[model samples]
Target: GRALGEDYEVRAAATAEEGLAAVEADPEAVDLVLLDIRMPGRDGFWLLDRLREGFPNLPVVMVTAYGDTETAIEAMKRGAYDYLVKPFDVAHVRALIEAARKQRALTRSAVSLEPDAPSPGDRIIGNSPAMVEVYKRIGQIAATTLPCLITGETGTGKELVARALVQYGPRAEKPFLVVDCAAIPKDLLESELFGYEEGAFTGARKGGKLGKFELAHGGTLFLDEIAEIPLALQSKLLRVLQDGTFQRVGGTEEIRADVRVIAATCADLEARVAAGAFRADLFYRINVGRIHLPPLRERRGDIPALVRYFVQKHGAAVGRPVTGVSEDLLRALQARPWPGNVRELENEIRRLLASTRGEVLAAEIPPACPGEDAACGELRSLAARALEEGGEGAFHRFVARAEASLIAEALERTGGNVSAAARLLGITRLTLRKKAEEYGIRVPDPDA
Candidate 1:
């Protein structure tokens, strides 16, 4: 009410089931939700899953403690619009609410006309600031025929973004051609891009095949590994960009080039130019609109969403039904450095889906284990969040989660030796066994 006064009236729900039922009864009545992560019986994360089921596009912001980055990321991965930390600033809250409201309105507008109206590019899953910036750029350049240069590390989704720009724009109905500059030999790169006349060379086709540029006329052409274009061919590409005209190899006629160009490079073009490998002039031409995709490590927050996406995509391929991933596997995934970026993460998820028959991915052993301090980190974060939301109010669930994690870790470290694990915990064997049972800790077989 403070933000929009009469226009916005908040209807509060004290519990998860209450909120779920209210939304289920009349989801249209609520424009947004501010859900606390540490509710009794069911936490904010639980409600997020339920809400997504009933209203996939409804904006639900997880209200977390100030430093619960893990929870915030998990919430977003579960399809929350954004998250708000405790001690919320009125201005920031208002801004998030307004943004979510607008986005929800837009989605509803589009979905009303066509139930499956989401464009391929709009489905680029991520909530990290870096991926958010990438999405913004995709929206900014989607409508125009601008020369866009996308720079990123290999497998960082440069080609995906280029396709999104075309998929979500006015040119979506037109042809989209892709040329891998590094894949083709330097000798054939020119002929491959601008085509050639019949009998232009010893092995030329009798009827002459059209180049990527001609085939992509009036649409968009993606040049992958753009920095690999040989110096001799750079001038020809520049001519096409400058005057929208290019001649077929060994032909006198100049063809009108009505294609929009999007170039991607994992290499450093400026450095390539300095080393006299890439043309500085051509670099500037394609740099009209630029997008730099961040490596996966920089945007680890997106791992959950990417995992969810890949699970949904590849699960049905092998006829498996995957509901979601386990917290252990998800945490382990986030711990990885992902040197190969999104591509590596995608492949890993695909592998898990193919290997596992269960609904949860944690059934498959994690690729990496999180640090020993992972529980401590979570404990401190939850404590701080609890204090901010309710001073001196002890959150038993937080303590329980920390205990469960510790017990599980100890059992794993002890090789299922009850006496050894009890000694390591400084507790009696019976207490250790009971705690392990309570936390559902499985002691792996030492021999097996």
Candidate 2:
């Protein structure tokens, strides 16, 4: 306090408890905290936890004798603005304090604007070009009221994207309702959607309940597995789309709803329409603004980012220190064809974190699918061929080389166990064995 002039006010406490008490007594007065790591009663890290829980916006700079990378990373994870080693320059400390203060102020301002605007949530985390484009499209679509149809394979985060759209959209202030069309019983779907008037059905409520459509007024209504919506109900839904009016069962009064419709489906609606099972008109209506989320295998570049995000998220949820994802583990993740997509990746990360005992992630990561290795070999062969040929002929060479490489790799991975390889490749075992013969790929014998 004596060293610094009136421009700064310094408070001294004998113990961590006293310091915490001083801050508790007057939180606003304390702009920055210079915490000593070896404080009595409670260490700086413990104090950091208290600050994080009570006042997350407050910045705490840890003071240590020697620099420790693990400790610094952990402290940063625990909300410490920065750390300062002992014998450090006074100017460095001043700079750190200023930077921390600026960061805190910025965080507070950002939090105040839209606390629930999906600010880098653990569900969708990536900064890759593909992911950036996805985010840009989401933001652009959020401004409009166009109906969106999200088509993706199971576990590709279709619903998460839908929620992002709703949360960031203009109608974010209103209710965002979700209806799992596939989960609801087909017989009761109409009542669930259009509501039944009093005495309209034997078990109808006395006051007549509000249907999901009316409940989602001035907001977004998300229909999951839209292809499951019964054919008969599809016509009623289409009417609601054409004109924002739906009539309650046994009631002549028409109810109008102002809501943005967003639908998701794993099934091919075109196929169902062709089969006369789904209404073509309804399909066309909901498919106005389509967003097809790429499967995880197609976006292998995002695996590392996703792994990091999940490790941090799950580690924090379980009160464990954030762990590092090893290069080998990342390579395994990249090689695997994530048929289940982001949801599958999240589950795998959670499992790894639960079984892991320390800070390294690779040790606990489970064995990867053998198919991944084969796929990687095929990709490498394709790259090699592409490099050998010039750019003009690279595309043709790569395609042929990839096909041959895949057939050879598949046969080799199965140990000439063509039947097993066939199943893995999603083809008949006989077809796989025949292809292996045609490609002249020497399949290894099981005995060898």
Measured with C-alpha atoms, the lDDT of residue 87 in candidate 2 is: 76
- lDDT tens per residue, model 1, 263-352: 998766775564344678999999999999988878898788777767766666768567778998888889876656777688788778
Over 361-433, each residue of candidate 2 has an lDDT whose tens digit, in order, gives 8754555546565346336434543553344666655564455446655655565576777787899866765
What is the TM-score of each predicted model, taking all chains together? Answer: 0.58, 0.56
Segments in model 2 whose C-alpha atoms lie over 4 Å from true places? 1-123, 368-448
Give per-model CA RMSD.
Answer: 21.4, 19.3
Clashing pairs in 2: none
Question: How much is the lDDT of residue 182 in candidate 2?
Answer: 55
lDDT of 1 at 394: 54
